[model samples]
Target chain A: MPGEHSSKQYDTDLETIRSKVLAMGGLVENQFQDAISCFRTGNVAQAEQVIKADENVNNLEVSLDDACSHLIVKRQPAANDLRTVMATIKVITDLERIGDESTKIARAAKSITERGVTTINHYETIRVMSISASNMLHDALDAFARLDGKQAIRLIAQDELVDHEFRSIMRTLITFMMEDPRTISGALDTLWVAKAIERIGDHAKNIAEYVIYIVEGKDIRHTDYAASQLEDRTTN
Target chain B: MPGEHSSKQYDTDLETIRSKVLAMGGLVENQFQDAISCFRTGNVAQAEQVIKADENVNNLEVSLDDACSHLIVKRQPAANDLRTVMATIKVITDLERIGDESTKIARAAKSITERGVTTINHYETIRVMSISASNMLHDALDAFARLDGKQAIRLIAQDELVDHEFRSIMRTLITFMMEDPRTISGALDTLWVAKAIERIGDHAKNIAEYVIYIVEGKDIRHTDYAASQLEDRTTN
Candidate 1:
């Protein structure tokens, strides 16, 4: 720390941007976890806190974007280094959107709480969905940090499972609402929160696609994950 | 077209990029319109076409992204020109997402046709929402072309109206589902299509935010459009 050469400052800057990307990812993960907790317990205060904290996530996105632009302008990095910076730029955006989804979930949690909590069996599917989505997000950031394309592929496959869970949840909720029309309002709120979790999975999958793009220079997006999931069903 | 000087080719490059953005926007708008028509008329053939057309949108995104990267690396543009490139990069992502939403709506249309459609009285709100969201998208693109921040703000306000329509549609569908359990499947299909249209509005709103950013050189994102929409309720 004491005798670093000025010539190595560029490496330091790149390292700083990388660490900040992870920091932003960490903040989003915590926000999502807190939102899930608030939904589980119907804790309005915690939900409000999650909403307020999204400002920090949004702020980080703006600052990191400016930092990346400055680096590009100053360094005029070679192709490889430019790819790294570009990947970082894209990753923060997905992270920020993940944070936005968390806020939406928090608001859904608040709305569900006000509408009154339903029995656990009706919402057990939501817990499963939250776990799947959160894990995909954590793994996505991990893959980005390590630049692991193989693991990103696994995370992308995991999204199909989340999609399966979503369809299952929607079916279950539709039946729930049909059996008891009085449960319609609460069931609708649950649907919103579940939809938010599914969107979090989508954002995580997008992050994984960026990881693959960085590692292999392959663009794997717009590939119809739903069609793949359908194939998964018929073959197995 | 053949007499242009080489010195003005930089402007030409930027203009080419701008026109491509609009072209992509037009393609997405058509996809959305076709998907809506499919839903309105139960036209499965048109829905399939909309789904297949998304590949073109995806290809345009990748090529434009590469073009932007090459421009930045080769030109090392100054701040103002750099902003245009960055904004174009972000705007295309939103347009691609809008295209994806159209595909989703197309699938929903196919599913609805299989489930059998209800009479028109139930879906009139969807038509209104389609117009609102589509207009926002068209105007957002025009704002980008003109660098008009004022029009972007107006488009932002219009997103609130689309959101309002979405909530109304959701409530109506819930009531419809409750009134007759036999209609549950059809109503759910309708719900999905409505949600996709609402998301198209959000994508358009995001494009408007990028417009404001380029015009004002200020970050106007994550500003709680929903909150302002709420304020618009009690005061007026």
Candidate 2:
């Protein structure tokens, strides 16, 4: 009770920062999903919308960064509080990057649409990868909001599956380009889309790592996924 | 003189952190250059060396972050000092990313070497782009070290040239893949290498922006480059 009373304003400041991060996360998730939908349905307008909405993500990042700086200056937060603020700063960066990846996907979708190449069958793998990556982003944010290290670890493991899917799709696209040179343009666009989704998965995994760092005060970044998985299991 | 005496230790701590960041930047620049060399010469051993050197970059980043955190906790640096530390933190992230991009280029070089495709004629453009980008990175780090906002602004303008080279390389690679399907795999590897180099340019640009922020207390990030250029000209 003594600690709670002493730190009311600090807690409120942290909460405000957290809410802003979550709001930004929600918008990034929507941007990613809409980008994928545009790619799947060839909706040029929706792709343009996704590109335009990136400004909001950018604005939120700037504001959140400013708020974090103010909090650190005013509060001089220590230990866990400092880690929490640092994690928020890092998380917003990954979120903003995810937004950029979404923009890349949307731009690729628009280019493919403009090229008048509507061969939809080749995109099944990309669609699946997009959904998986988006879900990872959603759950990564959930884990962060809940401060659930275990859930974050699980999301980190999921990155391998996304990577595997990406490799498989890349191979398939290469083969398609070799079989018929005419498919090169469309296949290249699909390849960019897949790369964007893979990058999004990477950003999501980075967020999960930040969550673990926040909750456990452990810097688990740069460690191999399999090694971290072993550590996660042994600890739990 | 009283203010200087009071903050002597704080200034020393900041200098130590800045030196670590410069060391890390030097290593990253070497890694990027070596990776490019590996690709141009098809030297798998050099490619492996570049990949191995990335561990040092990663270690440096961890120690630098720890040092920054310790300084923040102990000194509670305010205003310009706070901005300097924040910019250092952000710059190190970009430096670490440059290392990662170098690793990607090295890996791509190894793959291309394995493919036994030593068509060096097509790599002239990539070679020029790599040199340009490497120079930009070197200058950007020098600007950061000097806290020269004008030099940083100039580096930001140079990013446009790197981007133009990247797009031109992409178009040429695509054309090569379309003309000769047999070159598709090698072309893809080269594409990844080019993309990695382009991303390094972006990271360098990000560092320059951070330098400007540290010196001018202006948040020029995420702003239009042309607008910033105009501002830079008028201010000078």
Candidate 3:
């Protein structure tokens, strides 16, 4: 049977992987916020910056994956330690995808800005959705860093709000498109921005779920919402 | 100091995990095809079936993951064997998400069918996109089963075709929505179906990339399309 390495080097390696994940998470959060700002200000330049910065996030993911693999091979951690490494591997994938979604939002912002179309009324809804999603991402990373399952559970509840806001924005945009055919292209781009934000929320939820799995050794994914809610209440 | 296990049990265990992944892939492909047929026939019941079948995919993913963890702990596989197991874990995630995407498409189809809207002219485009995506999923599974890196590289090139078809369908749907405001809701649903189909193609490409990684021990993901195409030509 494989035994966990009793060396300080193994612990340091694990900590390094965790720290890298947090740094990557921080970069993704910044990218997401920048993408939202680009949407609000119609700043194609800022959007371009966000798009350009995604390469760093991608590099970070590769390095983190390598770190995790090396740790697994060298240390042969078992049980909870192994779970942490596995969860880190999974979490980085979500973080990298979140960065990709931010880039998509940035690209949509650039497209809409170049079209010179004012978002007008729907801007507020998009703004609300973006803020909620960004906050969820921030909090999820915090929970991961702290290994706080309770905080992660609370973050899971927030995805519903982000999703609701996304649907609300979609409805308003659809109405705007129907009222004026000229707005269809810009409105579709706005819809895509909202969709991207909503997906970020989903990735955040995935992270939160991973946090719970790492902390509690429970597999709560795809569980019914009511059951999850009950578990949240009971656990907390 | 870990030596490769030369035991038949180790080989059987690896074979079992591969079979499970292939079974999961088969289920996801069926779900995608069923979702498309539901769209074509406007059968809400069939769409519901697709949605309901997703639980099986989720279960398969969990079992496959657990089996992988057990294999890692018991066999302590190294080198290419370790990469194969790691790739299997990642591939199952993509397959499960593909099943989820199929469920999303089925849900969209149900909503559109309930609206009593016939897809009419757009049906052919959506059908073509779905078939291409389904074919990619099939080929990707075959590549994984055979450990055929060259075939997987060829499969990666096919994603470009699926993407092009997705864009064409989107443009047609956008035009349809703009021409008649009444089609906005249904057209939006159709756009979502096309988007889900596009995502399935993406997940298939991910599986193919994993196959190459397993066979060649090289990380080719996040590389540019031109580079991947050149790799495809050179590798084959």
Candidate 4:
């Protein structure tokens, strides 16, 4: 139980840190949702709000890094608790990257607002995709908090749906661009937003992998780490 | 110096890993160059060649990772050696991603070839941008191998030029799309290739930062870890 004592201490620090990371994750999720809303309703003000909030998101990421470093040094955690700490570190990196992608989308949204591009069919599809992606992000973080491997595994499977939707939306946008020369700039802007949402899905999947790692103490990055682990346990 | 034995072990292991990474780096550089060559010349066979070569590039990355891990365990290298191993791990990751981006560009090229989208402009700009980006990747690796902080720092500064060229190429492509709706799909394809090139530049910059970290024993990721280290050395 030597590792368990360290686990309890690390878990206390990890729980505190996870809350902060989730707060940042929530901010980034809001940014993606609002940026899409900005494009849909021509709410330039909402886009501007999203842009302004980026600095706070970035500041939170830096603070989270600082806190993680201090906790690692103090706790020197191991095993499942160690995986949780590592997961928090990596999840924040992915979440911070998601924030950057949101900022990129917000920038594109601003440009489209300035150009006064009319709403197109693809924009609505993008909005729907963003909602689904945001939901995945929420579920992934919840799975992380609860250490729910089943939920995490389910969320990983759902990521493919987001990718499929994104490709379909890209097809529609490209088709619109092909039919009208005037839609070119706006189409590119929409493409950027879609790409951002797709990346958000990637982050959500990364979080899900972390949940699996925490629950199973296995690496699931490249290989079918999760499936193999499940198979091993059943065989045992 | 007691450090020299560890340094020699690190140096030998580092040299072995460096050569392989640079080889992989060279392969990616060629992929971008060949991908665009396929585009401009409508070389379907060459596009296929680039696509096929990606597997070798990916395999080299795996080899590089194995080499790095092996060295870390064998040498048990401290601070500077540790930094070099860490740098190798990260640089290879970047190289692998660059390979992925290059493969995407190659796929776009093949698609363009299959669809017979013959109208291509701005080839001169794209060529120049790709070559410059290719050179940046080389320079970044060279900087890391020599531990040349000044050269690494210079490469970081020059990343802006890649951005400039990429933006110009994008603007030109958009203009083409605006002039003729028929050009929209081709323009979108070209835009992704340009984005891929830009990301390679970004990865190169990341390698440069790692070079700074190893040379100065500082963390230059977000904070000015190098600048503070320089100030400390000066004061001492």
Q: B114 in model 4: Cα distance from truth in Å? A: 1.6
Whichever of 3 and 4 has more TM-score, that candidate is 3
> Which pairs in model 2 have colliding backbones?
none
What's the residue-level lDDT of B34 in candidate 1?
Answer: 93
The candidate scoring highest on TM-score is 2
Q: Each candidate: RMSD to true structure?
A: 5.1, 2.5, 2.9, 5.0
TM-score of model number 2, chain B: 0.93
Fnat of each candidate? 0.38, 0.62, 0.36, 0.36
lDDT of 4 by residue, B1-236 (tens): 13644457667777888888878877888887888787677788998999889888877865666576566546656554555666567688788778777888888888887988776654565788888888888899788767798778777767789999988988888887888777777788888888888988988988898788767755566555445555666799
Candidate 2: where is the Cα deviation over 4 Å? A1-6, A119-121, A225-236, B1-6, B119-122, B225-236
DockQ, each predicted model: 0.51, 0.73, 0.61, 0.31
User: Which regions of candidate 3 deviate over 4 angstroms?
Assistant: A1-7, A119-122, A225-236, B1-8, B119-121, B225-236
Cand. 4 Cα-lDDT:
0.76
lDDT of 2 at B72: 85
**What lDDT score is found at residue A105 in candidate 1?**
86
Candidate 1 accuracy as lDDT:
0.83
Candidate 4 stretches greater than 4 Å from native: A1-17, A60-88, A118-122, A222-236, B1-27, B45-49, B52-89, B217-236
The order of the candidates by TM-score, greatest first, is: 2, 3, 1, 4
Candidate 3, B194: how far from true, in Å?
0.5
Model 1 pairs whose backbones collide: none
